[model samples]
Target: MNLAVFPRRGYVKDPTPIESCPAFSKALGGKVNIFIKRDDLLPGCAGGNKTRKLDFCMADALAKGADTIITCGAVQSNHCRLTLSWAVKEGLDCHLVLEERVKGSYKPEASGNNFLFKLMGVKSITVVPGGSNMMGEMEALAARLKEAGRTPYIIPGGASNPIGATGYVSCAQETLQQLFDMGLKVDHMVVPSGSAGTHAGIVVGMVGNNANIPVSGINVSRTKADQEALVRKLARETAQRVGMSGEFPDEAVTCFDGYVGPGYSLPTESMVEAVRLLAQTEGILLDPVYSGKAMAGLVDLVRSGYFAEGSNVLFLHTGGSPALYAYLDTFK
Candidate 1:
């Protein structure tokens, strides 16, 4: 709530749209109403949830006089793509450590964000196994850059730290304002949870604003328990960053892991159907890895009557549609 105390580079000058999804809602065949927060349209090379976090993270990098930015993520990481994209905009060299989350998942000639990594002028991209020590690797990269007389900043995967999470805190403010203006009350908010920043930031934001709306995360990587713990920790840290009580209020966070399907970035039957349904019904596309699966979960929940009758549910469309190029075979 006290955003004035912190510094921001200002990536979001305009609030992303909150639109009704009548076709998708009717597809559910329930009394429930559905809406979407189109964060996928946020500014960046391909636009995504990471754009919000970068507003703060990039500002910190600039204040530190960082000449190069180093960060890590999975092979097709939307966060990595957006980070490099913003780095280029700020005239900073960007380097990446891409984790092959699934062994042999890293293909130098791969499309999607991997292609963007090269196109965006990334100074370097190091591929490591899923279990590689990310912070240590980034530190070693920083040391090497220092020896070369370049100042470097290390951004954690997904910018999950307290500072980066503030972007979603601001997002919460924006969403609530929009809902009030539109005379709508959202009973539940759904998001794709991976690396925790977006989910945690929304939880922290909701608590800080006393929005009284529950934030549900469809876990894209970790299990429900693991993801919940991670999100709670980040939410608390984000709250502390803004001079809040730094404690996640009771029932502030919830996550569902059933939609992960085979594994990280692996496609599932449900995800494919959800993607197709949304594309056909709303002319909207959701990336395979994150939002697609989250949509699948939302779809399943609606069909299963998870929400009370006549409830209003909002899905946060954290974008990664550009990566759809890499998974061309999945759709066909």
Candidate 2:
């Protein structure tokens, strides 16, 4: 498929890299080689995976002559931080609807992304109770902007739509090139599955590029069946956007929900261990909610002999390390 036909919106650079995670490897007893695709290092606002989606989403916004950007996410959303970052960079106003998916988690005095949101110059923020209709909230925000005579563009959470997912498809292509250059072969790749864009886009990109490596999602929320369905739906839509033919096999989109403990953003014992291990071993910080849980799953899967001994596994470090601060007590 010719993805070039889609507007890149000024993010036309090659992807970061698939680098060896020596620290994380040693923590796992070196049972399997661990490498990371550092999407977390992608440029923008202390960096995170959402930058990839914003590359395309911002392009669409600019194309539509939007002067303001509106989006929604959980209170400590990395996506929200990055959205505001990009909006600042593009000279557009940014507004956010903070969802308290976990009741009482939305404190006006909270740290982490909330602090960053203010520092990043978000024009406004509206806090909604958990389970509020996000689309309705966004529409309301847009309507308010219209009343003020501003041209506003709405980007869905995590930019999970096809346009946002193209970031991951592009990321997959970049990963393949990096692997080739490094003379490495990745047998499997694991990533956090939340909004589903990263998982879906990577699936589409790998399939389009004929890279047969399986992409496994460690669910940060939702179940295996539900997450898989959401990912497949997004992947197919992304594939169609890029003009790729054929369907993504149902079995290809896989997720493991065994790791989501208690609920989203709630710390688990495994999550704490995973976070500390990565930080101490590799000096790489992972947020408690997403990447920490994902690493926990990856470690367990490796220990269970899911991958052959010495198999090279790539983990996409989607980045939310800042949120770690909010959960300081958990680790302490």
Candidate 3:
């Protein structure tokens, strides 16, 4: 695939790595060898998976000669945090539309990404009710910017569009190369499925490369049925963008929604334990919302013998550790 034909500004040439997690592997009782692709270490301000998407999204914005960026996400969103980070790097103004997916979570003085947003010098913020039309809200922001004489670009939430997802397609290719070098064959890969870009892109990359390894998504929000449909749709779109042939079969999009307790970003007992386990045993930190719940699901599945003995399970560590600081009270 001619992935280089796609625009990629403000992007690092290489992905992070698929490294051995001795701490986590030991914690799982050696039933399944656990490895992590440290996407959290991707070079960016505070770093996270969103950096990959923004590499493509921001590239397109720059190509279009935009001076300002507008995007939407839940309050304390890692995607928003990374978006503002990239905006600062590219010297573009950023405006955010915060969705209160959980009511009363949008405190202006809140810590974590909220504090970072201000520190990064975001131009403006619009707080929207949960489930509002995000596209409309972002367009309104762009119109307001234009009225003020700023050329604005709208990047969709999570940057889950096909172009943005190309980042992960590249990631999939990188992972396959890493596996070959390390002599590690991944039986199953697990990742947190929130906005679907990472999940979708990985699916396309794996399918296109004929890797044949299944990628399972642990949904942080939405039901299994709802999340799978979204993932499959995005995967197909992403595959088409990269000029990959064939449809991603519906059966390939697997998700377990059992870990999303209460609602999005609301912590669950399993999530809490998962975070603690990673911290204490693996010395790795997982955020409250996405990776923590996904790890919980991964742990349960491993214990349930979902994979045969000696199977190597790969976990895509799409980072959000900064969000952990905001939930100090929950952790305490």
Candidate 4:
């Protein structure tokens, strides 16, 4: 697999750490050994998994001679935050199309990523209703920017396209090398599945490298069937993009939808517990939207004997802890 074919901006210089969490593991009944991939500590204004995707996406945008960027995400989106941060660093203007997934959720006075969006000097922000056609909205914004004599590039929500997904393919290779050096073998891997790029890229990297590690996605929004199919499709596309040829197996993609209690960005009791547990136990913070709920799923699965006794499970901490400020009431 030649990821060199894809242009990357080198946003992430050093590999993120893989650390053991004994206290958190014991809290889950000590049935499985828990380790975390700290993509949460990845580089950006406030680090998150999106930086990995943006490392490639931003490079693609620059390579195409874009002087401006247009992307879409839910209100208080971590993806949007990181996208804007990198654009600022790259000296490019950024525009945002935010979807109010819940009615009246977009507030100018809101904290978290929204506040950061303004502090970082986004060129403009457009809020639309829930379930809006995000790509169309971005294209419309892009048209206006083009008319203004600005070159604009559109990055889909969460940077989940083949280009962005290549970042995780590189991540998979990095991880495999790390595991080999540490003499550790992870039995399974869990990730938050939203736009599918991170999950898909990891799947391709693991399979393409013949590492034989199964990647499980904890859905932040979609159903089990839907998220699994999306990851599988993107995995195939990412593999092909990196010049790998083979059938992308369906069994490689797995997801659990039980943890999404109400819907995307809504608070759940399990999520609250999971967030607080990791913070208190390991001094690791997880965001309310994605990583919190994902940790909740992993906790439940372990408590229910989902994995074999003495198994080692790796959890990908795709960061968004900065969004925690917006959910203060939920945690309270």
Q: Give the TM-score of candidate 3.
A: 0.98
Mind giving the per-residue lDDT tens digits that candidate 4 earns over 1-332? 88776778888899999999999999999889999999999999889899999999999899899999999999999999999999999999999999999999999989999999999999999999999999999999999889989999999999999999999999999999999999999999999999999999998999989998888899999999999889989988888889776888879889999998889999999999999999999999999999999999999999999999999999999999989999989977
Question: Which residue pairs does candidate 3 place in steric collision?
Answer: none
Query: Which window of ten consecutive residues has the lowest lDDT sum in model 2?
Result: 8-17
Q: Highest lDDT: which candidate?
A: 4
Estimate, for each residue in 104-152, the C-alpha lDDT of model 3 and write its tens digit. 8899998999999999999998999998999999998788789999999
Minimal lDDT window, size 10, model 1: 242-251
lDDT of 4: 0.93
What lDDT does candidate 1 reach at residue 215? 86
Query: Which RMSD does model 4 reach against the true structure?
Result: 0.8
**Candidate 1 residue 154 C-alpha distance from true site, Å:** 0.3
Candidate with better lDDT, 1 vs 3: 1
lDDT of 2 by residue, 62-117 (tens): 99999999999999999999999999999999999999999888887778998899
Q: Which stretches in model 2 have alpha-carbon errors above 4 Å? A: none
Report the CA-based lDDT of candidate 1 relative to the real structure: 0.92
Cα RMSD to the true fold for all candidates: 1.0, 1.1, 1.1, 0.8
Q: Where does model 4 exceed 4 Å of error? A: none
Task: Show the colliding residue pairs in model 1.
Answer: none
